[model samples]
Target: MTNAKTLGQAFDVLLQPDKFRDYGPNGLQVEGDREVKLLVSGVTASRALIEAAIEAQADAIFVHHGLFWRGQDGRIVGWMRERLRLLLTHGIHLFAYHLPLDAHPELGNNAQLGRLLGWQADGRFGDQDLGFLGVSTQPWSRPQALADHVSAVLSRPVTCVGDMGQQVRRVAWCTGGAQGYFEAAIAQGVDAFITGEISEPQAHLARETGVAFLACGHHATERYGAPAVAARVAQDLGLQHRFIDIDNPA
Candidate 1:
């Protein structure tokens, strides 16, 4: 068993949460058992994921999306109270890293997603440099082919916009609700832009600018970072780790 504080410190060192002005707190959100022998990692700290951690006898939980965020109601009631009650009652430590987890060089959401999709990040853009500019390892003859490959890799339907026949070579991407970065990516002169979600304006922009847009599911694209970081930490600290994937269609 390792001390919970050590685990938190390790994450802070690796992720450097203070570097980004994120939407929520980045470190230990909920205090639990001081000694953590089993660490459970997931995409989000929803009720289902917490219950799974409890079932697995995890002493700590690490996730990308945590229970609290800035600009949220401070009062602990309804779903918030229940979620906190579970963690407090069960003594499961909660560590959440939002922007840091997304921007990490190797184990981050963008890097992991690129690794999965065979894209190499050559540069960064957008707020806090969260967006990645890259090129597909193998150029797809058409945007549809790239979309098909992404859908198959992620096991979810990808919403592709713009000309279907448009060739996809140079690419830009940012995972999880990063459609807003589409315009900035287009300015970089990439042939295609991939993100977790797409907004209405992106469709029109794609048509007008002749840049392809692929909307992979937000949760699906972000599934890798938490698990990847957690596993590495667990290995280094000699703690058992389990990655519970609570299916999220969004």
Candidate 2:
């Protein structure tokens, strides 16, 4: 069985939180079990997810989204209180890597998406709080082809707008809730953009922007980074690890 100190140390090295200035505390949000063996990895630290970690008997819950943002209320109440109560009651560790997971050069969400879609390594495009834009190696085949590739890889359903067969040479992607960047991608002359969630205005924005848009499920798209990070940590630290993906259809 792993102790809390060793687990925390391994996560610090694995996540490298100093590199990305995140909105919330990026590492060890709620400390519980030290020597972690079973790890529950997911997109967010919702109440249900916390319960899942408990049900799985996990020592650590690793996720992309964790509690305690920069400006949010620090009080424990409502949903926050319930989440904390669950963790504390179970002695389950909560570890989150926010911007660090998104911006990591290799293991990040953007990086993995680019690699899966065969995009070449290019630097970031822009920022909203903190984000990056990636480039495609070869020009896009068609919007539908790209969308099909994304849906297959992410294993989540998708919603697409704009011409399916439009020629796509450039792509702008921000993993979760990045519809606001529709205009940003347009300004950059990107032919297509992908994000986790979409709003009603986003459909019109895609039409106005004349860019192919894909709304891949937020949970589906972000699941890779946590498990990849987990595997890396296990390999490097020689610790037993498992990434539990609690399904969220959204």
lDDT of each: 0.94, 0.78
For all predicted structures, in order, the TM-scores are: 0.98, 0.86
What residue pairs are clashing in model 1?
none
lDDT of 1 by residue, 1-250 (tens): 7887899999999999989999999999999965999999999999999999999999999999998898999999999899999999998999999999999999999999999999988999998999998888999999999999999999999999998878889999999999999999999999999999988999999999889999999999999999999999999999999999999999
Q: Which stretches of candidate 2 lie over 4 Å from their true place?
A: 128-140, 163-165
Please give the TM-score that candidate 1 achieves against the real structure: 0.98
Give per-model CA RMSD: 0.8, 2.6
124-211 in candidate 2: lDDT tens per residue? Answer: 6657333455567767678887788788887877898876657887788877877877777778777788888889888887776678
Q: 249, model 2: CA deviation in Å? A: 2.7
| Model 2 Cα RMSD, 1 decimal | 2.6
